[model samples]
Target: MSSTEDTTAQSSIFKDCLARRVIAQPALSDTPDASSSSSSGSDLDEFISYLASEVWETLPSQLRALTHEHPVIDVDADALSLATIPGSFTDTLVSYGIAADPDSACDFLRSVLRDYVDEARAPPPAWSSTRTSECEICERDVPLTYHHLIPRSTHTKVLKRKWHPESLLNSVAWLCRPCHSAVHGIATNEELAREYYTIELLLTREDIQKWKKYASKQRWGVRRG
Candidate 1:
């Protein structure tokens, strides 16, 4: 067999052996092993850092542009990895059938990253003509657009990784055009999807608060540069 085929065959055998070992093991109590937990957590962090280094630059420019409250273009791989996604990292990997080995973990992460990009590029859901009584951010009576609290771009990975409940994917906020633009301008889609998936959380940021104050004063028909 070719080298690639040989590697694939070996991987299949490894997974089969691992599955059999798991099936033969007795079920443990609900409590987890502290030492094993710590080790797995460390492994997850290392894998994320390595995967960030491998794929950070290749991420879409918009994906790399902003994080929670800061520009992330120059952020190091460690920080990028931490801010990229949220979940019980080790558990998510096992649930996805990704092996604990670094090579296997990184390979899975790369595919996840590709899915993230594809989702980010996908067209957003059709906007509803309905407008809330006011912008949730600025509290102004104006024409509003739907701002997905959990951004649509991260929907695929979020569901795949079980990071957030599926119901939360359809949650949204009504924001005036300016407020909606500011939301995207302030943070990347991943940040919005992972961290600021609610108006309360978004308002917690001082920057966002400042923008709300400024936006509230502007006339409804005014366009911001």
Candidate 2:
């Protein structure tokens, strides 16, 4: 078999082995071994740092330009807060890449945070209906246009790698027209612009679902009276 085919076969086998092991494990809520835990944590940090660096490198030139315009602050502390937490970043990393092991991935992320704490800056605020009028890129009120946090180009580039549509949307943001133009370029490329709109439509579905849940809660609340 070809090298690619061989690799795929091996990966499938490994995944099957892991699944079986998980099924076999007894429920253990007790504390884990300290040394093993620490070692695993360290591995996670290394993996996170590697992944973050890859992401940074993969960003579009326009997006990178914006970051360059802004000052870089220590990100280690914030990274720790985001990385250690059992949510978005951790989930994204694991889903995007087949981590060697889960515990090791977690630990490596922590160490990565520690190393880059000083270099990290707070991300720009998210854009929503309330924030749409404001420019996300420049924080000004200039006919803001939604900018994809993860550009369509980037998404397409990474599509070959394992990633879900929902995870892709979670990684993007909205920006103003000028800022969007500035980041992308002055030429109005209709096709490229359309891709962004498509992603927005996908994200809208999420908003609608949230609204539906909220409305259900409100209706239930009223019915309880």
Candidate 3:
């Protein structure tokens, strides 16, 4: 038996699915898996395939041809743009009859990809050094993030306290991750500084409560347009 024959005999029966193709990795430790490009809510591969498939509509001859060659391929964040939509992708879209203007479809894909990239790159929000990890307002056992009671942008005019490095962190409120994002979404920095600066004051706002309720329904960070 030759080397090729020996290798084929030894290799585990190959499966068409991704789990078979990917090198079995240890469960991610302390960080998310960066190797896979797929995202939970928005699937890039399926979207492209759907556009090319006959199930949606008949694609143009050119796009249909591309389906066989580049059915699904991984694209990086930098390549997610109107200018960068590969020829194969454009062909696939046209073949599926989904391309009214190829540029329009490309723009939509870019926006969706940009959203995913933003999520992947987002840094964890920081909390005030003075406060414990637990939220000061909701008292939930969640990740803590700092809330600027006076809003850091106010620093442009004058310092809220003595200008130590931790001065801003020291002066801020300790809030749960949800609450911190909620507070900023509802009220502008000026409003937060002038009107709602304390737990009692912030908790009473109807907007904050509404935001909290809205956030609870979302699967991730916050529901955005």
Give the whole-model CA lDDT for all candidates, comma-separated. 0.51, 0.35, 0.41
Q: Answer with 1 or 3, whichever has the higher TM-score.
A: 1
- lDDT by residue for model 2 over 1-225, one digit each (tens)? 454543333332222222222112232111122124223333333333334544443323322232212565343333334334455444544554433445544654444332222112223334332453544433444333456654556555445543445465435445543234333432233333334334344334322222222122211100000
* Deviation in Å, model 3, residue 164 alpha carbon: 18
TM-score of each: 0.42, 0.22, 0.37
Q: Is candidate 2 or candidate 3 better by TM-score?
A: 3
Ranking by lDDT: 1, 3, 2
- Among all windows of 10 consecutive residues in model 2, the one with the lowest summed lDDT is 216-225
Cα lDDT tens digits for candidate 1, 36-80: 422333332333333334444444444533222233332223233
Could you arrange the candidates by TM-score from highest to lowest? 1, 3, 2
Query: Residue-pair clashes per candidate, as listed?
Result: 0, 29, 5
Poorest 10 consecutive residues by lDDT, candidate 3 = 12-21
Candidate 1 or 2, higher TM-score? Answer: 1
Query: What TM-score should be assigned to candidate 3?
Result: 0.37
lDDT agreement of model 1 with the native: 0.51
Q: Pick the candidate with the highest lDDT.
A: 1
Lowest lDDT 10-mer window, candidate 1?
A: 22-31
